[model samples]
Target chain A: MATAVNFKSEESQAELIQLVSFNLDREEYGVYVLKVREIIRMSNVTRVPNTPYYVEGVINLRGKVIPIISLRKKFSLSEKENDKQTRIIVMDVDGELMGFIVDSVSEVIRVSAGEIQPPPSVVNGGVDQEYLSGVINRADRLLVLLDLERVFSQSERESLINSSL
Target chain B: MAILCEDEELLEGFLAETSELLEKLDDDLVALEKAPEEIELLNGIFRSIHTVKGASSFLGFDLLVKITHKTEDVLNRLRKDELKVTPEIMDVVLEAVDHIKLLVNDIRNGEIVERELDEIINKLIPYISDAFRESAVLHMESAGTSEREKEVPASPVQTELETEAAAPAQERPRIEAAPAPSPQPPKPNSSKTVARGEELSDNTTVRIDVKRLDDLMNQVGEIVLERNRILQMNQDYLARENTANFGEEFSKLAKRIDFVTSELQMQVLKIRMIPVEKVFKKFPRIVRNLSRDLGKEVDLEINGEETELDRSVVDEIGDPLIHLIRNALDHGVEDPEERVAAGKPRTGKVVLSATHEGNNIIISIKDDGKGIDPEKLARKALDKGLVTEDQIAGMSGKEILDLIFLPGFSTKEKATDVSGRGVGMDVVKTNIRKLNGIIEIRSEVGKGSEFILKLPLTLAIIQSLLVDVENEVYSIPLAAVLETLKVDTSSFHVVGGQEVLKLRDSVLPLLRLQKLFGVQGSETSLNQSYVVIIGVAEKRMGLIVSRLLGQQEVAIKSLGKYLADAPGIAGSTILGDGRVALIVDPAGIIEMEESGVTGAWAA
Candidate 1:
């Protein structure tokens, strides 16, 4: 919803936007702050059989069952070990709550909507361009704004799983 | 229109009350068709229509008021015996009831598509049995009348209706309770047949939205889990050596909390239950219409209508029950002449009954008309290519009968709108399966046929036996678990290259859960293992597990939309230890077993 608002606001001026950025396999990916419900430490995840390989399984979120996915596995990046900084970012994707496992959490960053450019044709971080809403060029490092909706879409997961099979 | 627009609540209240009254009216109307001389039924029908008329008139729903007002006049004449009950008269009355239903529904959706009320009113006018010219004059005289005159005082039946209606609604337990002072002989259940005998009338019910109950159930589920966790913690605390004296007090408190929570959960589950009569009531009307249309003499006897089921199940079980009843009437029951020729009674019997079996509800639809022929069903399946010659040759009689549930396998040569297009049975099977229920067929070639459906009483919470495979736990609903036993590896023998366990008198197919779920880490205890035997319909399979976690009351939680269709996994639930365990879908695993997914064993 915040992304939709940002996109609409782009017509008049470059509105400032907030993103909850995190690290996945050394690549900085940011999701709109409004989409992020919370960040919590990694907990026990019960593996569910016969799901997509990237699905890390499910966790009990305050008596609710929430599916957790491995962003590294999802992006086809080299898997990394969970450390002190590992966190699960619970976000709202198309009205359903799903959690994504990331290497570490980063500080909230503000970037002008105009500063975020269209995803380049050849991205080097192994994240698909379609999943990237835009690339943000911060002074210290490159930040990729993620379109969590597209990344976690039903058809996208189904097609990916089917192709892998 | 202006009044309804100004007070939508009044219109809504009218719609709700009228719809319920209309449903009861359907059943009463059908029963009246069978016993046309029941005065109490006539009076009750008249009062219900009069109530609808009163409410609609108050709401200024002019069209509804006009139609129901006319219906009331016709019913009043019937009540007074001024008009006789005949098929043509019943048809017109039922048709008017149907139009009232449409108008109520249209009002509900905020659009009225101008039905021809004049035609039905004119049709009902002839049944008034009074001089039409005189009645017209009376109607004109009553025009612009006060509310009291329009509502209750005008009709002669009103005075008697008021006295009876004011005699406490609590005297009625069953909506279609046998008429008071019934002229028929006493039924076996004397309590039910004895009408209006109770003095206590304090039980008043409030109408609640189902969603509110669902939310409350979820909250109670959370409370149950929290209580379980606290109890587990207290046990851990008591197990330690260094414990304060308060620990005993704490443990007692936890125990009390546990008992209270369990009671609370049970009560909430009870609140979610609705008597199966909500669905059963509609069937009499359906069977009546179908039998009349087919010109067959069939009697629908409903038993165990008071069986209570979780509301969700009751809501879904209606359609399948309807279809099965239709199937019984349309195909199972023979024509009156055919039955007479076959040396059977002219009035074929179709029994729709429900009964509680342990923790499950078993609803059976049985017909005494004509039983399904296994060979005939097999021939139909073969013709449809639903099964091959080899398949049919290998199947038993029950399996052959089961072929009717296969898609596109119908015995009827031509599709009839009344349940013979071959499309319904399979859908029925799917729907029952979705409710975690199993449907079975019991038939004799010449005697009769019965379709029995066994369903869990509640979907939200169930008693499940949790088992472990490679330290990963799974919960199998105890309703499906017939028994659990510790068996030696050597006792298992291979039959036709599939693992089979000889348990007592029967050979049970063995499915190793470790192999089916592909749980990582090899099994270290290879000698003795636990086998949880589960069955649906007539097929049973013994699931081999490493350790038994005993029985638990588990609240079923979905795997969410992302992993909703996990194969062999029914759902997920949180254990007392706060870890998630998958609930095994025994039916799905049974299907897999049929599909030849039995993993290879080294034994």
Candidate 2:
């Protein structure tokens, strides 16, 4: 019988962290492994009323409504240039399965928990540190770990809810 | 090993469960207004609040957890008959639900928000006993009431005792029982005491984003265009082949391609089909607020909430429908005293219903109010110089009612915030025309008025009657084409220096596409000419074209920024041979024709 590898368990036991990594433009970013729900191919998303610019819109994921956010736009990147490899990463944040559009998802990396360091304050001239949970150096690549909850301000989040109402 | 990891997934399961519980809470609240005595309803609402409070506290959303905890206390009291479900109590609870919805929205937006729930919690405190308010730690510890509180006014204390009383009497052996002799008021309804009766069953439904469906539609359109191109090519090839085997193969290929393309189109169209419930849901709240504000007794009855419409149409229809409903209440429905004086019921009725008829959905807003007075409308039109005295004398009642749709025309003496600020029915007409829909109004003085709006089921794919003027092909939406006829050239005569067609005693203005599009005239006169009668905003006109082409389902592709504002053209579509065919905006053309503009020449 083929066994399903318990990566989360092994990582915790070995004091290693599993990161769900994806590519944005040319840079690599990783979120905690537990945040990710699954990876799905691009599907139809219905535009919702009164959403913010970065929110591409909401989609019906197997009968459950989930909003899709364009990470590129969220980070103030230029408008998307659609390519074959463009994908949406479905992640469960606070129980909501939100799909964030990205260039493509890379492999999950296992790094010792001790290897993760606090994010640099002035990486590339004052990067937005609110979104950065931590940073891990893996070989030649610097993986910027994201704290997804910090992406929105309190008032802005309230406005989003008001618009939905 | 896997069991430990699966604990992470438990949070997601809890979220799904909590959201479902919240939805039930909302539906039950709305239902409680109609059936307040259903104890099961109160218990169901209490359980949902309890579950949310439990999960929120566990998840460390302190503010949400706190508010839900307070709300649960109030609900517990209400369930035990300690507090009546008064209007004030309902308001506070609904406000709490609104706050919870806001919190959910915040979480959805990826914010760890600590909201100020003090105001809502304070409002709810009046419903709870003073003991529950004094000590937060005590409230958390004592989940059950003391046996001495049995005679207390139906408080959260009594509810806990009741639940304990249902359990084995030995379970409370340590409690003092001297207060059990206190007299209690008999409950009004025996059936309202049971807890499980009011819980509403979960009806799971999903909300979809419309953009995905639009993208799918665009892809299907391209496939249909490709299929048409291939079929056209096959036709040319098959015409030259005399062999039976070649003909059979070509036909088979064509059949398969046709089947696939049609199915693909239908599936894509299905995604755009959303029930009218989204639009209808807001109306109940609107009517409630409006009736309260106006101090009028009005009941809003909505039927056919399940009617499906294209998502695009549904979005656009909301504003217009709101305006129409407000108009019906303000102008059509008289005040209670006025209604009673007029021999009508003291409470006015506004019925908003939608029904699917053939390929169109007919939505009617009928109100039993003071119907529109055509005489007053005619007088206003004449006063505003919109119509001459002679025109009023010759006009019918329906024609006079339509005059209200004229820009800057309103019979109301003073402008109010709701309806009459002089931005009259013209906007409604313009918006309906933009959707390629029609609106008709019927009224009888002292009786009532009804506004009927007819809209196509889907705007993505439309069957268009293709016609040619000079050398260019233009598509007239089949919905607007009333009829086509072959008219003798002699039937046309110059009226006011413009050609007019006289058909059966009705003089309809004739618009030629060659002249409309700035295409040079051919200089050759044909005795027989094709005339397509098209309707725009309730007015019908004859469109004189050179030839009539067969109808086909054309996928509407928007003309990019440069040509979007061009008059007389709605959008462009791709033909079988990859040629772009401009679809005629009949309403725009009719407006241009009425405005006496011959053509729009590029600068």
Candidate 3:
């Protein structure tokens, strides 16, 4: 029977978790800090046949082929016309190493865990919420948390594996 | 380092929820294909998309949210009965799902994909009418939809009149008239209702990370090891502690521990269970695309998409299935004119089906078109020097079919866009072999061909028959072992300068484990000789071993980078005694035997 007052008092000093944020188009998104394996500049990617449209191709990382996906195309973002400020974030999901292309990475920011709120029913003029975890409000900007695991299920990941092979 | 403090709990929750939604989306989409008019299914699809859209939007994944929203709009119309579920419409929705899959992948990579949704949106445009768009605003406000019912009433009156007038003339006319007014409302309405019904059903589902499940399996394996130690300790204690009723107590404790450990092991294995529909869903589009590209009329049919398999096995089986489907479409199916000339149906039928056979899952891709011509395969094999004239003469039809899986072998005179790249079937064999599965092809000229793939329920744990070659132990997957026999050395005879063992009536080439693995052993007596009969790619041989141990369930551990490429060793496993025993790759060993390289063990 605890009311909103009880929660407010408990939430007075909110817990903040630092996240490395990046931008795609004009919006900023944050991924779990530990999920990221590395950040590197663009590299040559070999095209794999019969893959989904958003998969840019696969890159050879020390002889191991890792699929590279364009975050812009994946999220249905407007295709970037230029290569300026583009970066690839490499991450390991379910024991597979995959790379994601982003516009540019911003600074790591610490926002109170309590400050993060469940995604609203609608956002950015009615954008969908399949890829989002939650939204964290910073001083003047908002960081959208991403659910990486949901981003690729076992089947989708298998497609990447098949194309790579 | 401060960034490391970011709470993963919330993110994990999102992952779990979204993944569950995606899985539901996948299941409903597959079901939708079977029962296209099921309003409840349409509703289920609508909710899945809506939920995904809502979640992505909240997470600030504008790209994901936006695309899902567009797809949701199309589904919303479907659920409302404004849009009809035509194959074309299903194609668009499936493609949208593929796009969503790509978006999810992109999100996982921590990238924002911004692309024009116009292509997908354009695909949805023709389905929507001005009236539907006018009512879309009202539908949005109601959320639950008096607006849907409004469109339905108006359309139903006109549709009923059209149906009454057109029903006497032709079935196509009524279907065409019903869908023509506005395709938008039915799509969303169907999905929405279906989703609501599914939500109301008392089916409980839990989301799990596959990696975590794999870790749990590994931990259970360690516990089994610890249990073995405990059992041994208990036996020793029982002998030392000469108290009465010791036997009863020790036996009960051992049985209980065994039961608990086995249950725990089974529970962990179940966590990795995934339906075969995950692999089945992509085939419809593939079949459609291939049929169009090949200029052949094919009716691609699928059955038993609900079959469950381990995640790892499912991951490995997709490529082989694709190759089989491609091969069937390209080589098995004849052209329309040829079919008509043969007095058969002009439209070829390719049926992909899965069913459980005993403990194994059998997936068969059958085609009702031109079957494999054994003579043609034999001629090609001879032309390619894959087999000699004598070999071809002695070969059976099944043997000829097996020749197609040989690397760089293609019987097609002219390479087409669909196939004949000479890379697919061999890859199918290799991949299937990697999963410890077997592929068999059956065909007759002028009839159809069927490629059957027999796969284990899971790849993580395998029942292996432990055998001793000299002093070292090796595991042979029970799936590959046909029979074990104790051969008398006197029954061996030399044929073509190779030792062969006569079992029953057939002569099997004898490959001695000691000589094969370079183990120094003294000559053994005839009565003591053991032979393990194994089959690979339709080639059967007898593996002569020093001793035969009983079968046991073994958890596979990859040999990692240092030893992965090592010949003869498929992977390693820890026995109950905690000793690492290498699992033998029967296919690799068979390849070695076929290539006239019998000295693999000597190396």
Tell me the TM-score of each prediction against the true structure.
0.84, 0.61, 0.62
Provide the lowest-lDDT 10-residue window in model 1 chain B.
Answer: B194-203
Docking class of 2: incorrect
Candidate 2: where is the Cα deviation over 4 Å? A1-165, B1-31, B38-77, B106-117, B129-244, B493-507, B594-603
lDDT of 2 by residue, B54-86 (tens): 555545555565667668778888887888887
Interface RMSD of 1: 2.1
Q: Identify the runs in model 1 with alpha carbons over 4 angstroms from their true place.
A: A1-12, A157-165, B1-5, B110-243, B488-509, B523-525, B592-603
1 versus 3: better lDDT goes to: 1
Query: Which candidate number would show the highest lDDT if scored against the true structure?
Result: 1
- Fraction of native contacts under 8 Å reproduced by each candidate: 0.69, 0.00, 0.00
Pick the TM-score winner: 1
Q: Better model by TM-score, 2 or 3?
A: 3
Colliding residue pairs in candidate 1:
none
Model 3 has an lDDT value of 0.69
DockQ of 1: 0.60
DockQ of each: 0.60, 0.02, 0.02
Model 2 lDDT at residue B175? 25
